[model samples]
Target: MIWSLIILCGVITFLIRFVPLSGIISSDLPLSVKQSFKYIPLAVLTPIIVSDLSIMENKNFFIIDNFKLYAALIATLAALIWNNVLATISIGMASFLIMSNF
Candidate 1:
């Protein structure tokens, strides 16, 4: 019963999200709407980044011992420099492994 409820909720959520997008993309959107949509990616990403950065268990903001943070930062720099996901992930994993050991 719980599983069925969960599945039903997921389907409803997906339909609610997709139906509008399907309509918008299928038909020609207005110029104003298209222009407004250009900021959507940044708007979505900014809050996520801020939320991740702000949420922490300890008082120290740096969290120097957290290997995941180091890995993610290194990965972000690598991605910026190389423009490659594989390289970024490899660098991140290597950093994580090195940090975890020490």
Candidate 2:
């Protein structure tokens, strides 16, 4: 049973990593379809950012009293001003930690 589970996991992992890079499935895609891949990062990040800014209380989404939302906005402004990834991440994390604590 354990070996079968390991083999199943390995096959799933291989398929996940291989299907995108194999080029076998992308050969016949339209030009627009190929170009749309450029938005993949943005598509992935939007939900993450939104979820981080919202607070779940009593099974409801609440924006009020969410310090994370304000901290993220401040960090975004800092990133725009600094234009540095490290600085942006540092500012974001620091703001998040400070806000979470108090």
On TM-score, the leading prediction is: 2
Q: Tell me the lDDT of candidate 1.
A: 0.81
Question: What lDDT score goes with residue 12 in model 1?
Answer: 99
Residue pairs clashing in model 2 are none
- Model 2 TM-score, all chains together: 0.60
Question: With candidate 2 superimposed using the best TM-score fit, by how many Å does residue 74's alpha carbon deviate from the native?
Answer: 1.0
Residue range 1-102, candidate 2, lDDT tens digits: 999999999999899689879976765779898799899889999888887667676789777778788778888998899999888888988988898898
**What's the residue-level lDDT of 54 in candidate 1?**
48
Compose the digit string of candidate 1's lDDT tens values, residues 18-87.
9877775555768898799879889999788645644365664756676777778888999899999799
lDDT for 56 in candidate 1 is 68
Model 1 superposed RMSD (Cα): 4.4
Which pairs clash inside model 1? Answer: none
Misplaced by over 4 Å in model 2 are 1-29, 56-59, 100-102
Candidate with maximal lDDT = 2
